[model samples]
Target: MSESLLHRCPVVPVVVIHDAAHALPLGEALLAGGITVAEITLRTAAGIGAIEALATALPELHVGAGSVLVAEHVDQVVDAGARFVVSPGLSVAVLARAQARGVAALPGVATSSELMTAVGLGVTEVKFFPAGLLGGPAAIRALAAPFTSMTFMPSGGVSADNMADYLAIPAVPAVSGSWMVDPGLLAEGRWDEVTARSAAAIRAARGSGAFQRVV
Candidate 1:
């Protein structure tokens, strides 16, 4: 896995596009805000098309797939041009498939046992899913205590209000959430709003620069 994958952007927009056509404009908006990474989720049927559109049209954006639950999903996104794969939980099959496909994989780990399993698989990075409910930055700090070599990206319940807090942790290089790319904003075609929120997120990340570097 590329160590710099999570360091490309401080806030990776976790996007869910209901319409594939919205993908390009959204990617452009993210770029306008100085964010260089996006995680287009597979929660919707248009996910594959969205990933392909962004990957083909906006090669500058480090586009990745989120909410990947199976090995087949990994293959689908990779073929669709995803550079990375993110799951809500650890899955040996998903990790193996992603490795076989030669793409970076970030499997979520909310427990020490799960993290140990990831380490066993030679994973150097992980996503701390449902970060807020899992004790937020405090949880990551505790987890990082034993796994000194591992780095993390916190997602779920993460927002601008507490994003800086998460970035303060030495183990977290970035955080992922949907605030900048809200479903309502996408449905309304509010590209400017997306850009504004995305810019704000970038500023927040910059302010909390302690963990901005790759671990």
Candidate 2:
């Protein structure tokens, strides 16, 4: 796992690209805004192509594959040049596959049991998914109480308004979200809007003063 890639950007753009052509422009916009990571989800048909495109076009950007639900998905992303892999939920098969492949896998965990399972798999950093619905910062804080060594990347419901709150938690190392880089905007080829939104979100996350308070 490349810890530097995970920490380089406070907010990772969780993107679902329907067009492979839009990948490069969207990636450039994100990088321009001081964000170096992009997670191209396989939720769309063109996902694999988009991931390959971004990896080729934006070598400086750290590209990852998201919504990886199966073992084959992990192989697909690795072959597509994904630097990391993210799953919506943790599964023994998924973790084992990722570990065997030697890629950084961030499995989603929303409960204490899930967190424990991820820890058992030797994952130190995890994704606290559906964060807003799962009690958000309060839930994370409570979960971190017993597992202080574990950190999280809170996704789902993360927005500029509350990004600081999530980052303020000592258990959170970073966050992943789609609010900054809207799929509609990217689909519509609105690169400028995406760039601006990415910049705003990055500023909000970094300006929160939370990174300095990590304990």
Candidate 3:
């Protein structure tokens, strides 16, 4: 499940929806732009509802929960039809609960110790949060040196300008960020702009040789 989800798109848009009504259109816009996966964040009250709306109404758009912080949150998102769960940091309870519930968990790892913990938990994929602050793709390359079996998805600080850099690393199967689904664009209901950005991102990913690198 983790491999399938990661390979669906080289750029996973990290979305934060303030209104559930906008969920359907957003999903359609992404699909129109050639993106297949979205990480709807639990950063707002409408997040869970948005997840459910998209998951149920547009099953083709692989929906997942982001900014998930606890075991309970995992239950909430999985129940809402999230195919996967992402957190800002690794948590034993979160990973355990996700495994128990049969949902893929992509917990964040910013250090070698965290990566070790995730490995012990049987996690094969992880999100590298605040990628820029943590040294971006170079940091991921260094961190992945010993964990050759693990793949990474760089999240925070990821943007079109630097997404290619992240995808250039063989260990990075995908990159996640909110640039394609920026709050301002959503607030203004600029679905066209969203589609354009999403399409451009996909084009960039392909140009970066993401498909050739993904195993």
Candidate 4:
């Protein structure tokens, strides 16, 4: 897991694995499809094991722990070989824990105050969570005016359809979603479907035209 991996691609697959057994294969499929970063959310009991398995199996791919809301969750992910951590909301305690552990943390910020707090805490890159419900690209554009130095990884409701919209905003560093890694397909053991979707998402993001300007 490399800190720079998230920036290498515009989209990071937000994954939720219920079966730890499928972790390695699923990660390989995503990586084979040109998607290098995977965010395994701790939304299920299998998430930690899945992260561990994927990290061990796909040494070249970047694996991040997401939905980390507590300080302890940070420790758990760090111990499980997570290269970075992401939270749905900014928490001073959570950020402090990640900083102390020397792990890259992308805390979520939905408002100016939250963004300011993250900036004050030395966080330049954050997750614009629930992006669609929060006004999507327009909202992020407005926030970027005062915080020109800040960057974001907008997640939640982010898909191929609106990835271009988010990438057009200078403030957004990247975007993430589970659209590439469909849970239904995973549950049905459809690795081929997952790989195809992942490939399509990677191509769609690359073809969006906004990445050229940013790069």
Candidate 5:
């Protein structure tokens, strides 16, 4: 991968768009807030269509697909124009499919075994899901010490309130969460609120000075 996902943007908005029509405006809102990349999860039926819509409407945004659980889902997402793939757990089949499709895969790793497995699979970066519940920054600190070359993106429970904490760790170049693009905000068509939250998240991450280079 020429550009690492974590470095593309300090905060990668994890969005669950209920309506495919909302994709364009949502992308615009994120871009307006200084965000250039985002992950549209497949938790809802509209996920794939949303990815396709955003891909066609906003070519500049580095859009990715999240909640990818199966290898078939990987194919579906790639066909929909997802530049990358994100999963909530480490799945060899899913990662392998992403590699075959020739896109970056940000698989989740909640334990050392999973991290090691990911390394063996040629993955350099991973998503630390349920981060706050899994000991948060402290856990990442301890887990990251063993893998000097690996980096992490803390997911669940990550917010502006604790984004700085995650960025403080040298291993974490960026963090992922839905606070900015929460489903509720999207459902309400609150584009302005989305932009505001996105801006605030970026400002918080930048304050840590950890966004030196994206790649």
Candidate 6:
């Protein structure tokens, strides 16, 4: 199950949709570009609706909810039919609710302390937030060495140019970013551009020559 969530695509687009109307077409664009997974962040009111729409219309896509912080938020997203949930920081309340709901959870961590907290809670996968500011790939390499069995999803400041750098590390099975599905493009209804960028991102990740079977 984790493999299906994090291994199907090396790069998971962290998308923010302004309108629920664009969900299906956006998922199609990303799918056409060789990407079968995406995290539709709950940064706006449209977020839950988008997740429901995507989960219903494109069950083939691994639709996830992001920026989820509390138990209520978890309940909301899970009830909306989100297959997974992502948070900006580790929250036991959210994690517990997600677990109760049977949805995969990827909580964010910015330091070794938080990482340890995740490990203590039986988490094997997490998001290294603000990765670039925390030293990007280098930081994750150092921080992950101690855990030895964890896989990190590097987000924030992750981009096309630096994807290879993150993928170079065996611990990083996948990296999440919004470069391909920028909110502006969705706002403009630029479906073709979205598809092209998604395709280009996939090619870049595959050709980075840093990919390894993480699981």
- What tens digits encode model 2's per-residue C-alpha lDDT throughout 78-101? 999988889989888887888788
Residues 1-215, candidate 1: write the lDDT tens digits: 75557777778999989999999999999999988999999999999999999999999999999999999999999999999999999999999999899999999989999999989889998999989899998889999999998989999999989999999987888899999999999999999999999999888888888334632
| Model 6 residue 56 CA deviation in Å | 0.7
Q: Which regions of candidate 6 are displaced past 4 Å?
A: 1-4, 209-215
For TM-score, candidate 4 versus 6, the one ahead is 6
Candidate lDDT values, in order: 0.91, 0.84, 0.90, 0.84, 0.91, 0.87
Estimate TM-scores for all models: 0.97, 0.94, 0.96, 0.94, 0.97, 0.95
RMSD from true fold, candidate 4: 2.0
| lDDT tens per residue, model 4, 74-97 | 999999999889999999999889
Candidate 3 local Cα displacement, residue 97, angstroms: 0.9
Residue 160 in model 5: shift from native, Å?
Answer: 1.5
What is candidate 6's TM-score against the reference? 0.95
Q: Residue 8 of model 3: what lDDT? A: 70
Error of 2 at 152 (Å): 0.6
lDDT of 6 by residue, 139-186 (tens): 999998898978899999999899988887888888999999988999
Candidate 5, residues 79-155, lDDT tens digits: the string is: 99999999999999998898899889999999999999988887899999989999999999999999988999999
Residue-level lDDT tens digits of model 3 in 137-208: 889999889999889999888998989999989888899988989988998999999999999998888888
**Which residue runs does candidate 1 get wrong by more than 4 Å?**
210-215
Where model 2 places Cα greater than 4 Å from the true spot, the runs are 1-5, 210-215
Candidate 4 segments exceeding 4 Å error: 1-5, 210-215
